[model samples]
Target chain A: MDFRKKLAIEPGSTVSLADINPEQDGGIESKEEGKEKLSGILDEITPLQEMLYAEKKHALLIVLQGIDAAGKDGVCWHVIRAMNPQGTYVASFKQPTEVEKAHDFLWRVHQRVPAMGQVAVFNRSHYEDVLVARVHNLVSKQVWSKRYHEINNFEEFLTENGVTIVKFFLYISKDEQLERFEKRLEDKDRQWKISASDYAERDRWDEYIEAYEAMLSHCSTAHAPWYVIPANRKWFRNLAAADIIHRAMLDMQIESPRPTVDIDEIYRRYHHAVREA
Target chain B: MDFRKKLAIEPGSTVSLADINPEQDGGIESKEEGKEKLSGILDEITPLQEMLYAEKKHALLIVLQGIDAAGKDGVCWHVIRAMNPQGTYVASFKQPTEVEKAHDFLWRVHQRVPAMGQVAVFNRSHYEDVLVARVHNLVSKQVWSKRYHEINNFEEFLTENGVTIVKFFLYISKDEQLERFEKRLEDKDRQWKISASDYAERDRWDEYIEAYEAMLSHCSTAHAPWYVIPANRKWFRNLAAADIIHRAMLDMQIESPRPTVDIDEIYRRYHHAVREA
Candidate 1:
């Protein structure tokens, strides 16, 4: 199955978060099977990423957005880590600083977008403006409402300029979020990841769902679509995100540029150097 | 006199490079008068720059394009230096490196554009993709022609996002360029800047003028218009550029942002610290 087509939120279609199942596993029968598929997909991604770096014709931007403990960081560790670090960068957006708040919302985000031959992963991205900002009334409705249009224009501009953007909305049920929160508390190794605010935010789950639905419906453009990933099962999320990213890289069709110098002349010079040595 | 109005290439207008006098001095009678005016404008600009940095509402992007010895560097030294270096940056775009050539023409340029509350002066910029690229036949007509639209869209996008772009085509006569080149050879301090290509490029002066005229005509838009500064007289170039830049900043109307904290509460805390000390 082409996960890119299967998972993507259709452009211009309304999305109801309740209708989608978070536990859907893309037909993988078990966690071990999913992990095996993820590993294979990751192996395929390494060379494709190198070709992407060598070609330097296109940039890949992977945006991951979800509620607390929806595996945004997990996708980075398990899926994105497969790509070479030299050509890939991860930018995380949290609360805006004074300097960032002073400009238009996109100013800080634009600075972090990848250049050609690179992949940028946004752990929590500009979507937070709509998701978190909308849920908390951080800005007036008039302000945040117009941002949907601005974001579409910005994404369209990036796509036209050879950036391929794949946004993943890591979907999880409310119960799954509570379960993950409890797991974080139980695991001393994962205690740092737990925060009191994570539980507090659960109270606004419905509001957040409304915000996410609006974001998915409005900002999903043909050039840059949002993918709703079933992320209740961590292993399945990793496998699906890895598979989708691998597919996107393949679609770029990147190839090394034609040699600008005379290969024969360079080869002759190299032989002369070897003889002298 | 509004130098911005006098110097700007009207949007949607054709340009005749020969028709505009490169020796035009903006009606300033002597070097002393122009220098004095420039100095006054520079002084006024310092405070405005602080407010700009504090407000963080708008960014200033100044693009300088000119032939060799047309005083592109002179404008930066004499005018742009007036702004605080903390908030100002000078990015010089020379020959594209192998890595830069790998990406789209605008990729490197986009990365260097100013963020909010900052000023960026491009010593030589994306116009080279059109000017030098066209005059030297570095790219085909089809490739270079499409860039005019691309550049306009890029500039429009920047403007919509609160960047005020002021592009200056430092206009100079062929005789003036030759004179300046000779001066460069004569002055030991300036001898390093003298290049064989400078003389070679002069042979294509007419072609370059055609290329530049096309650029000015096509890419000049309402949001980011091109200013053809008469640069034969170096002092006048400095004066006209400084004056125009001052006018543009004034138009931005950047006031310091309202304090985000309570002044009374902060004062009380400050007093408490002082009392404890």
Candidate 2:
């Protein structure tokens, strides 16, 4: 299936993680085949990103989110490795600093959005106001519920100001997660990835799913859409993501900017003086 | 002379524009020699900036201020051309947008300070509060005068968070500015840069000088010292600015971060999986 057609959450449609298979391989027959397709997609993305940077007229924001071990980092690393580091920016949201906490929730996120002709990837973004903030009773239900509309309006404002937003929810099943956790235990280099809270959070998986379902339903607008990528197979997850991002760039109709200066006139005027200098 | 030592405004000392000659060209004997030294400085800056971005621990903010055609843009353009575009950020302060005017004067400037492991250049910075606001009587004397201390404290807070601040006041005489404006009128490519307001602002040169002198004297502190650069000659301005910027980066003592993951162990665990994929 074309992942863009299959994966985009239609506006007002309810989404359930249980109905979506985490094991789907995006129609690629094998891991090797998927990797090859992903590499091809990467080659396509690099030049489009260069055009986006050179044009200096539009901004692209990619928001990555997932539960623990859901491949957010893996997808960001694999996919963005294709683009020039000069034009690609990554802002990983951690626990809010005291200064950030003093401002409104979107304050930090808004400040870090891609400037004109730039691409900024948010490791976790304003959606966390709905996810972790909602899940932990950090605020009242009414407050979290109101944030969906606020986020939609804020994103609309950004789009009006030339930012294009793409969001991804990496969907991994509990069984697959346990298998990855087991691997983490056995691999010395990966042990740092394990935390007691990872298991604690895993136990609350159903609650998170309900929260994600509401988020996917409420905030998935035409201007900024969310893609639900199957994450049990890491290679397939990266491939499908690469395909969606490439399609979004194609949708943007990106063209490089025309030269600002009249080069011939400049040469005509300054040619003799330049040689003396 | 070391540009850092020569240019820094000694705190608590009264400043007089008459005491300094804007036409003075550091100690460089010739423009060609200055340009060669600038190229060498740029070569030194590129690697240091790379180490800074990799280190992800410190931030540098360079603030430029001057009258019209004092070469704020020139200094920023020439100095920053040496650094990696990925790691260098430029925030040019134009007339305040409505939203910016709604908040405290420093609100927009504080938002644009450098983040960790980044170099942020402010083409015109918060110093405008002292200069333009004071010159035009935009704010009450009580309000604008009190902001100098507030700004000093705000900058200190940034320093405590691992930021190094450098401020430059590009000092050029009224005669030099008029000559430059005349040149702008002659050059078709530069005509867009000239405005009726440029001439109007030129009439207030002495008021601007007094304002700048006060700003240099009152706000120049040991931590984030101000440099009053004699900027009549473009070549000398670029070289002296580059020298001071290099000195600031050197003081940062930036070093690349150590590897986070154990390479040998990652090799041991992931080698087989990598081969299969």
Q: What interface RMSD, in Å and to 1 decimal, does model 2 have?
A: 9.3
Best by TM-score: 2
Kindly list the per-residue Cα lDDT of model 2 for residues B31-86, writing each as its tens digit: 99989998999889877887787677999999989999999867755677566544
User: What local distance difference test score does each model get?
Assistant: 0.84, 0.83
Runs of candidate 1 with Cα error greater than 4 angstroms are A1-277, B272-277
Q: Which ten residues in a row have the lowest lDDT in candidate 1 chain B?
A: B268-277
Q: Give candidate 2's error at residue B66 in angstroms.
A: 0.8
Query: lDDT tens digits, residues A1-277, model 2?
Result: 5788899999889887789999999677899999999999999998898778777788889989888889887776678756665466677787789999898899999889998888888888999999989998989999999999999999999999999898999999988887787676555445555556676688889999999999999999999998899899999999999999898899888875553444344334433233122
* Candidate 2 TM-score over all chains jointly: 0.57
**True lDDT of residue B142, candidate 2:** 97
Q: Cα RMSDs of all predictions?
A: 17.7, 9.3
- Cα lDDT of candidate 1 equals 0.84
Docking class for model 2 is: incorrect
Q: What is the two-chain DockQ of model 1?
A: 0.01
